[model samples]
Target: MKIGIIIPARNALPYLKEMLNSVQAQTRPAHAYIAEDRSTDDTHEWLRDHPDLYAGMRRNRRRLGWAGSLNAAAALALADGCDALFTASADDRLHPECIARCAAVLGADGGRDFVVPYAQQFGEAEHVQASLPDAGLDDLVRWPPLIDKALIRREVWEQVGGYSAKATPPGTFGTAEDWDWWIRVWKAGFTRYSVVETPLYFVRVHPGQLSDARAEHHAATVDLLAKLHPDLPWTAESRQWPPQHRTTRRQG
Candidate 1:
C-alpha cells in the first residue's frame, strides 16, 4: 500500500532533523510531506533548502494552527495518490519499522480502519504511553486512547472530512483536534481500530510543547468538545483531565 507521512510544523527547526531522520529510516519507505505553518524561525528556509527530504512541502502564508497545517500537507499527499496517510508531529520520531509494521496490519486486515502504535514520551520527561487495544468510541469519548500520529486509511480520512480546522479562542491553539477527529471517525461508523503494542512512536515532552497547552486549556477544550458532540455523554467529570498511568519510566 502506498503510504504518505504528513508532518505539521511551526518553529520546529530544532526538532526536524531527528524527526526527518526517523522518517527516512523507515523500513518500508513512504513519501514524506511537510506543512510549514509560517514559522517565525528558519523552519521554512531549512525545509526549502532540504527539498529532497520530502516528496512535497508547503509553506503557509499565515499560521494554520496544528490541524490546518496537517490538512494542508495531507491534501498534497492525497493528491499524489497515496492510499494511506500517517499524520506525525514535527517534534516526534518514529521507529524504523513503524511504517512497515502498521502498513502490514492494514494491508492484512481489511476491517481495520486505522492502526495506532504505542508511544513513549522522551525529552524532558520519559514514560511509556500505552495504546488501547481494540479501542472504540466509548474509549475515545472518555479520554484520547489513540495517539495523534496514526496510520489511517485514505478512505477513512476522506469520509471523516480530515481534521477539524475550527478556530479556537483568540490567543489559544486547538489542542484537542486529534481527539476531535478520532471521535468523528468513530461516529462515522469506522469502529474497527487496532493497536500495535510496540513503542514505535516517540513523543518529546518539554516545556511549551502542545501537551502543556492541552493541560492549560483542558476545561475549555472539554466544553468545546461537548458542544460539538452533544450526543455524547459528557459530564462534569469529563472536564477533569484524566491522569495518564505511565507503564514504564526511563531516564531522559
Candidate 2:
C-alpha cells in the first residue's frame, strides 16, 4: 500500500527541521505532505524554501485547528491515490519503521480499521505508555487508547465520514476531537489493534503545547458524545486490558 504522511503545522518553526528529518528516515519512505496553517512564525517561509522536503504542501491563509488542517491534508493524500494515510504532528518524531510496521498490521487483516502503535513520551518525563494491547468497541467508546498519530486505510476514513468539521476556531475541540473520532469508528464496528513493542512515535511534551489543553473542553464533548450515541458503553471505571497479554512484534 502507498502510505502518505500528513503533518498539520502552525508556528512549529522550532522543531520542523528535526521532524522532517525523522520523516525522511522512515524505512518504508512515505509520501509526506504538510497542511501549513497560517502561522505568525517563519513556518511558511521555511516550507516554501525547503519545498523538496514534502511530496506536496498546502498553505491555509487562516488557521483550521487540528481537525480542519488534518482533514485538508488527508483529502490531498486520498486524492493523490494513496492507499493509506498516516498523520504526524510537526512537533513529534517517528521511528524509521513506523509506517512499514503499521502498514503490515492493517494489510494483514483487512477487517481491522486502524493500528494503534505504542508512543514514548519525552522532554517532560521519559516513559513509554503502551496502548491497551487490544481494544474493542467498549474501549473506544470510553477513551481513545491510541495516540493521535496513526496509519489508517482510506476505507476507514470513508466509513467514519472524516474528522469533525469545526467551524468555530482552532483548538476549540481540544483533545476531545480524537476521542470523538474513535467513538464513531467503534460505533461503525471497526476494531483497533495495539502494536505492543518499542515506541513507534516519540511524543514531545513541553510548556504551552496544545495537547496539554486536551481537558479544556473535554467534559462538554464527552457529554455531547453520550447524548449522540446513547448505547455506547459509558463507564466510570477503566476498561483497559493489561498490555502483558500481547505477543506481536515488528518483523523485518
Candidate 3:
C-alpha cells in the first residue's frame, strides 16, 4: 500500500458511514484501517458489510483508547510498506480532494515531515468561527494543517515514537494529542509545512465530541504537558483561549 489512513474509533458508528464515504471519495486513495478500540457499536458489522473497499481493517482485542490503537494500526501499515500514515477521527469528514492535495504538498521538494491545512469546525462559518484562537499561544503556534497519510516517511516515526500510550484517555484528551505530536515533531527537527489555501478536514462539533466538552480535562492535560516539558515556550499558556468577551483585568 502506498499510504495508510488509520482511524481510531469507539462508539462512533453513526458517523462511520459519512467518514467512510469521505475516504472513498478522496481524490487519492490509501489503505484504510479502522482501529475499533473494542467498540460496543455495530462497527464490526459495518466493516464486514464494506469489506471490499477497504484494503485492510481490524479491531482491537481490548479497548486501548486513541493513541495506542492508532499506533497499532500505524505499525501494521508500516509493515505493509506504506509510504506514509495519518490518523483521523471516526466522527470527522474529509473534503473530496483532501487526500490528493495533501499528497501533492507533502511530496514536494521541501522535505516536510508533515503538512498542515486550514480546518474549521463543522456547521460553522469559516471566517469568524475559527476555533479557540492562538490565545496566548505564540503567533508561530498556529492550528495544524491536515496531514496526508500517504506521504509520511516511516523514518520520521522511528525518530519520534508513535503517539504516547500513556497519554490520557480519549474523552480526556481534549485536542491534546495534536499539540503533543507537534512538540515531538518540532523537537525532532522535522520540517512542518502549512497549506494556506483550503481545509482538508471538516471537524464535527457536538456536545459529545471529546473536544467540544472537556474543559477540566483539557486544562489538566495542559498542566501535565507543562510538567512533562518544562522548557515549553507557552508553559501555562500553551494554545488555549479564555471564554470569548471575558476580561481578567484589575480595577482601580
Candidate 4:
C-alpha cells in the first residue's frame, strides 16, 4: 500500500537529525510531510533542507499545535493519494522497519483502521519506574504507544475528520485525539492490533516529549472512552491490557 508519514514538530532542532535519519531508514519509503510549528530557532531552516531526503517532501509555515499540525499533515497525505497515513512526533525517532511493519499489519489483517506496536521512550532509562505513574493507578493515564507511527487507511481518516482543531484548556480537548479517533473507528467495527515479535517503534523521549506529560492529562481522554468507543468494555482490565489483547466488545 502507498504510505505517507506526517511529522509534527516544534523547536525540535536538537533531535531533528536523529528523526530524519530514522525516517530515511524506513524499510519501505513513504512521502514525508513535516508540519513545522513556528519555531524561534532554526527548525524551519532545518526542514528546508529535508527535501533532499525524501521525494515529494514539503514543509508548512503554520504553527498548529501538535493536534492541529498532525491533522494538517494527514490532510496533505490524503490529498497526495496515499493509501495510508503515518504519524510521528518530530522529536521522536521510529525504528527502521516501523513503517513496513505497520503497513504489513494493515494489509494482512483484513484491513484494520489502526495498527500499533510497542514503543520504549529512550533516555530517562533510570527514572522509568521511579518517575512515571501507573496507567492503572492514574485514571487519567492512557497507555503509551497508544499509536504506532501508524499507517492509517486514508478512508478511515476521512470518516473521523481527524482531530478537533478548536483550542481548549491546558488538558481539555487536546491529547488523545488519536485515541479518540481510534475508539470511533473501532466502534464502527474496525480492527486494531499490536505487533507480536518485537517493538515496531522506538520513541525518543527527553524532557519536552508529549508523552512525558501523559500523567497530567491522560484521564481527560480516558473519560471519553464511553462516547468514543460505544461498544468497547473499557474497564480496568481493558485499561490495563496485558501482553496484548484485541477485541470489538459491544458496549453496555
lDDT for each candidate structure = 0.81, 0.71, 0.61, 0.59
Q: Which should have the higher TM-score, number 1 or number 3?
A: 1
Question: lDDT per residue, candidate 4, 117-229, as tens digits?
Answer: 55555664321111111121122223432443466778777776776553222544355565555445544555444443445566664645533545435444454554444
C-alpha RMSD between model 3 and the true structure:
6.0
Sort every candidate by TM-score, greatest first.
1, 2, 3, 4
Clash number for each model: 0, 0, 3, 3
- Give the lowest summed-lDDT range of ten residues in model 1: 243-252
TM-score quality measure for candidate 3: 0.78
Superposed model 1: Cα runs more than 4 Å off: 167-170, 208-215, 243-252
lDDT of 1 by residue, 122-235 (tens): 877767777677666666556677667789999999999998876253466546688799889888998787888888899888765534535447677777888888888877
Query: lDDT of model 3 at residue 164?
Result: 74
| TM-score of every model versus the real structure | 0.91, 0.83, 0.78, 0.72
Off by over 4 Å in 4: 54-62, 126-145, 166-168, 171-174, 192-197, 208-216, 219-252
Error of 1 at 158 (Å): 0.6
Looking at model 3, report the run of 10 residues with the lowest lDDT sum: 243-252
Q: State the local distance difference test value for candidate 3.
A: 0.61
Please tell me which model should have the higher lDDT, number 2 or number 4: 2
Pick the TM-score winner. Answer: 1
Q: What is the descending lDDT order? A: 1, 2, 3, 4
Residue 178 shift from truth in candidate 4, angstroms: 2.6
